[model samples]
Target: MLLKRLIVCLDVRSKRVTKGIKFKGNVDVGDPVEMAERYCNDGADEIVFYDITASAEKRPIDIEMVAAAARRVFVPFTVGGGLRNVVDMRHALLAGADKVSLNSLAVEQPDILHAGALAFGRQCIVLGMDARRVGKSLHFPSGYEVVTHGGRCPTGLDAVEWGRRAEALGAGEICLNAIDTDGMRTGYELEITRKIADAVGIPVIASGGAGTVEHIADAFSTATADAALIASMVHSGEYTCSGIKKELAEKYHLPVRLTSN
Candidate 1:
């Protein structure tokens, strides 16, 4: 198996890193740059900085914050939120993001996916799928549907099929976040994650609902995800990046890099 990564997520809104449950009632966490630096210092494999309200407000992601966070972290970084075109993708890359994630913009204009891949190569373009369960099986077109505008509006698109399409469109990886499980601390929506991972050929990073180290283990072992994106657990002091890595390494015998290079 490929080395599984443990990523710390920073959801930025109005220049602050904030987190919320089920995409609502967000609470301010801290400064994006400061929090990112702390995570980088704590041995985060990679960092994800998302301008959480850019799409909802129909504005571009805060370039200053992106640049600031990029400057503090040496590890690979992914930036998303309000990427509307190739220009935005280029801008984010220029600002220091190793990869750019597309959510609403991809749904609004899927050609952007191909355009981004063509312009920057597939390795630099990531498709961020904000999905929710709609039915019995958690199957795309039947169980999972796309939610946009910071996961507030339903797009009525089948998420699993979209994962397949994202891979075909040259997306390097898929970041699948289960809306229902987001920040609930109940555990991941394994069935939903597995379906998307099985449907797509590229790496999938399972997001949302991870409350424990065991939850992270379950995500990789059962859902077959290449990585897991964690937020509240890390942000709320429930665990540190090093703490989680230590626990995972000891418990699952998985390789976890806990030292800063």
Candidate 2:
């Protein structure tokens, strides 16, 4: 198996790193640059910054914040939200994001994914899928629906099929966030996660609901996720990137990357 990654997520709202439960009731957490630097220094394999309200508000991502984070964070950094076109994506990459995540824009205009990949190569194109479990239905046979605009709008697209479409459309990766379990501190939605992971040939980063070392372990072992996205656990000071790595390595015997370099 490939070495599983431990990625730290920072949701930026009004320049501050904020987090919420199931995409609601968000509260300010900290500065994006400082928190990102801190986590990077703590040995995070990658750092993802989401301009949470950009798409909902119909604006652009904070490019300045992306540049600031790039100055401090050394690892691979991905930025998402409010990227509308190839020009916006170009600005973000120029601003120092290693990858640009496409959620709302990609859902509404999937050709942007092809355009982005054509311009920057597939490695820089990441499809961010905000999936919520609505149970098995005729439309969502996988029982998971993709939500957009910060989870306020349901796209009526099945999460599994979306993953497959994204992969075919030149997306190098998929960050699958299960809205039902986001910030719940329980665990990843293994069912949907596994389904998407199985459907996609690209890397699937299982996001949301990371609470414990065991939860992260379950994501890799059971859900078959290539990477795990963590927020509440590390942001709350309950777990550090180093400690999580140690636990996953020693106890669960998972192949977590042990070095920052």
Please provide, for model 2 over 195-215, each residue's C-alpha lDDT reduced to its tens digit, 9 standing for 90 to 100: 988987899999989999999
Poorest lDDT segment (10 consecutive residues) of candidate 1? 133-142
TM accuracy, model 1 = 0.95
Whole-model Cα lDDT per candidate? 0.88, 0.92
What's model 2's overall lDDT?
A: 0.92
lDDT of 2 at 217: 95
Return the TM-score for each candidate structure.
0.95, 0.97
Write model 1 residue lDDT over 64-123, tens digit each, in one string: 887887778899999998888899889999999999999878888888889999999999
Displacement of residue 2 (Cα, Å) in model 2 is 3.5
Q: Model 2 Cα displacement at 10 (Å)?
A: 0.2
